[model samples]
Target: MEFYGKGNLWNFVEEERRNMHFTRSLSFSTDQNVSEPHESPFVSPKASSASATSIPLSPMSPETPWKLSPMHASPSPSLLYHCLASLHRYEGNVFSIAISRDFIFTGSESSRIHTWKRPDCTEVGHIKASSPDVRAILAHGRILFTTHGDCKIRVWDVSVTEKFRPKKITTLPHRNPFFLFPKKNSHQHKDYISCLAYNDGEKLLYTGSWDKSVKVWNIFEKRCVDSFVAHEGHINAIVINQQDGCVFTCSSDGAVKIWRRVYGESSHILTMTLKFQLSPVNTLALSSSPSSCFLYSGSSDGLINFWDKEKTSGRFNHCGFLQGHHFAVLCLATIRELILSGSEDATIRVWRREEGHCFHSCLAVMDGHHGPVRCLAASLEIEGLLVYSASLDRTFKVWRVKLLTPEKAAMEELVVTNDQQTEIEECKMSPVLSPSWVEKKIQANHFQ
Candidate 1:
């Protein structure tokens, strides 16, 4: 049977995959006609929400914890997403995005770290750094951390007064006047710092570097307390399971390793290794619940592999994978039950995991960026969810997403089907028209 609308097409496919227990499901369409780029006040889903699925939220804190207020569900059956604003600057491509409290931070090839306010996404101020090309940024509570191309990490104390100037607290590998010849191998990263994670309970910071090592820093001490080689290749991403102090790191070596602190010592020891695919893993995200926990790793092959945390063994077992993106999966962000992935294909796919099973469904595919999506940040809003994505195209966009219950989604689908039917019937009765030469050229370029 022919599908009338793209919405129905994806929905039918997803439903079939769900029933068949298939992992490699959606194949994103790349042959759509091209349109001129324009900023819309609202977010239009590239795919309809009728094909989407959402799960209930269990009160849990993600790696990047947000101070969220109680969410009041919308009564609407259809999904709602708004493009609150698009933030852009002339600086080089945005490499990282971080959300802390009410402020959003964007780091780029420039030394300045730009800041924007929530809701409106208005520019406040920026913090100038000592070096160019800020690669990674992590903000927690009032403390903010940024890594530069110099392979140095800087810490800042953020205060939101009239001006958004954050004070420079200290730099990692604290410079000592007495010890002029400090050992670089023991103190500073040998290569670019790629990612950062913070453990609030221990007040410690984790930094993963392209030098294939992971370092633990004591926030108060302003020094690296422990360091170890994490992977055989460049370390790409690092995430911490705050519930337990277990740290997870992925690398270009095509491996994901788990590390745990040695009892009361500051050092860490490898607990387990997860390497199923030969492709390089680029990013990771962790989801925790009272009943079970999950670990998601995005790799170079444009597939997301997830693992189920075993309660008795305290190890992650390979569960399954999510397939959709046409290019490498570059970054991942998790909020509650939602998993958002940015890819080299310049699109973001939203996925929701079923409550008690390993089942996952692609909720939506968002496309707007002209280049690879480099980084992503997300937080829960009172009425919906806020997602911030920074792209290599030198722009960052804020999206507010609202999901519907399964019952509401089913009802909404019927209405969408009726509307689609009328449109299809009208097109059938109308005479066919040829597109203009310019439109055809644009479409040709899109496919090329």
Candidate 2:
């Protein structure tokens, strides 16, 4: 895409694309000779041998068949796989992750920002701003917008390189600042920004805050286009469905608000109101469809609720609730029919949407980090389905769903066998085995 304007913003996007191209070429050259293995785990000789029967067929049997039928082994486990490409370590928990065409940006509790490559997860740049805690990162074309605890939104140009790093081009601070969710009698509160999103096609940036408000800004003109008080409680997430020209926002008050920009006589009018309610909505995600729309929102009560825009009267009914993670769902991403969610329970769950009323089924449960998962992002480039998740463990992980190679399957099988043998050896050495050992000794003496 051709980025307009003549300054640092244009230069930065160009430089990032150049660097990405160079890295892509280098990776291709290095990975050309590495071929993936291709052995089928289902058709193993041991499995086939085990299927054979030891007893002869009975004459009274219907067919008098002695041999077992050729058994077709069960289909291999869906071939889903994940690999850690690079780890971005932070001082505190990472709250959100965003990716553009080239770079992956992460916001952390340390009030710092980090950028990395898409598939490789190579660190590209870093920035430390006055806002000590960053809550959201939104990237549109060439600019990266961040919302922080200082009750201000900062805009940075991500294309220009200064001292081998991208420099901040401009910063936009919030005009009216207040506590995120102020109590009835509390006056010393500042509204904390909970989420940020951008509609590049419309040149508009949106932010949701704990003050139960959603604000929109025009980046090209550098002014607030419109602002609306959206929810009764803290707004948790905001997502722009550019295809339908509808902006969706969810809040802790358990409601999802939809805003549409209506072209007025002179300027534009942001017609905003509550679209539906998915109580205690913590995360929001839109499907890839352009006409009939669907939204997936996760709640604080460990429920993933689905809402179909074309079916109900602007009301989100819980079509299906995925039950697995025990804590609050923090972030969610949808790519076609696949949905990936991260939660405070320190687990990442992948779900596939089926055709029936039961929309999604758990496909994989990734549990390695010892801390709560805070954010998730899905990448469709380089890897088919890549998931980047940030957690309270102070590390960001990259996971991709790919078919397992034969060599990997072999290695896993060997590891399983070794573990089984070790378990058997431990059982033999256990104190509880003394009685069995005496019985075995007596039987051996009698046989001899």
Candidate 3:
């Protein structure tokens, strides 16, 4: 018994020694060993596990503890983004997040649209509506537009005071019974309003609905000016290009279509259609810079497909895709060259496109939510960027991203990836139930 105990301990120690040597050898293995297609944002996969038998290890000393590394890595600018604050409410699942000049707005399953102040993310005020559920809220200058589960849209003028008080402007398709009858076509949406987009230049608000239609409302006039069937499936999201007044809509039918206003008229005409993967696209973001323009679509298959607009051709062409999330990407927001995607995997990933190139790299993965992340909003700051995210877990988070140089960011990413790989290797080497515990359990079972 004495020899058995000592020998077992010696074997364990020797096995650990061998494991350290094996891990070191594996660490030096080339990145070409990784073959998974969806392992990273970059074209080439990082040092993720290639298969069940072969595990990749990061280049690190045996004495290094895996927990010492930060959860997220710095992006292209080598900027490190970390969560600054979290806002929690048991009211209901937050469905949308929007940012204006001063306030950050979040809509939930409840009728109230919650507001938080900029920089500090302090709960400043809220807007209550007569409807029972507010599915989406959007802010343009001082104007607030809310879409309800009751299939209606409301306009409000948000007063920027110490306390936020939004004055009701008017509801679309005027509810006046004398002007419109129940049997008559009210021009209002026939089904639930799913998403909204606004064009300040055209003074139009575009609402996409589960009814598979897109409705255009004249903001100043507060009435539906045009309506059209946009897709065969429910419309999921819509975005507008301010420079050209082009509206882009994505639907559950796995298609994206672009529309342009007829010259000097309220009518619109379909300009283009983009459909690559059959996966249902949930969100869309258009990143337009002085030098480049790209449109990104997040879909149910966890792929972020982006299209680059041709300068001379004036058409968007499918360039490449960003793959990192393990589940459906529910929401997406872009600021400058950086894109933030919130997924059903309960993680928010940051990706940056090269200034003038087609290449993109996963900078970081921010995770704190216990449920699917639903909506995201981000804005550029002097120091870095500010990200506001809402999730089905009924939580809102504010993140501050600090930009670092490319060299420093690359080094930081290497360290983070190494830490993750090391942790995975460690998990593989260890078991939850030790032999000693199993032996004890077996003996107790025999006795019993």
Model 2 misplaced stretches (Cα beyond 4 Å): 1-75, 85-90, 160-164, 174-189, 265-279, 311-318, 355-358, 403-448
Q: Please, what are the lDDT tens digits per residue for candidate 3 over residues 46-108?
A: 221221121233244454222211333222335555567776544456788888988887787
lDDT of 2 by residue, 1-448 (tens): 1111223222432333233322223433464344424312112223222211122211322321111101101122333444455353523457778887778888876555766766676565466575556888887766778777767777776663443255565555433237566334222125878888878677777878888777777777666667667778788898888775678888777777677777551133444444343447789998756445567887766778776664446444446567766556778998877788887556677787765344666766665444557789887765557878876555677766643355654443332333333432453233221233234333534654
> Per-residue lDDT tens digits of candidate 1, residues 343-380?
86667778888888999977666655555688998888
Runs in model 3 lying further than 4 Å from the true structure: 1-77, 177-185, 406-448
Residue 192, candidate 2: Cα error in Å is 1.2
The per-model lDDT (C-alpha) reads 0.71, 0.60, 0.71
Q: Candidate 2: lDDT of 337? A: 76
> Sorted by lDDT, highest first, which candidate order results?
1, 3, 2
Q: What is the TM-score of each candidate against the true structure?
A: 0.74, 0.66, 0.74
lDDT of 1 at 219: 85
Q: Which is superior by lDDT, 2 or 3?
A: 3
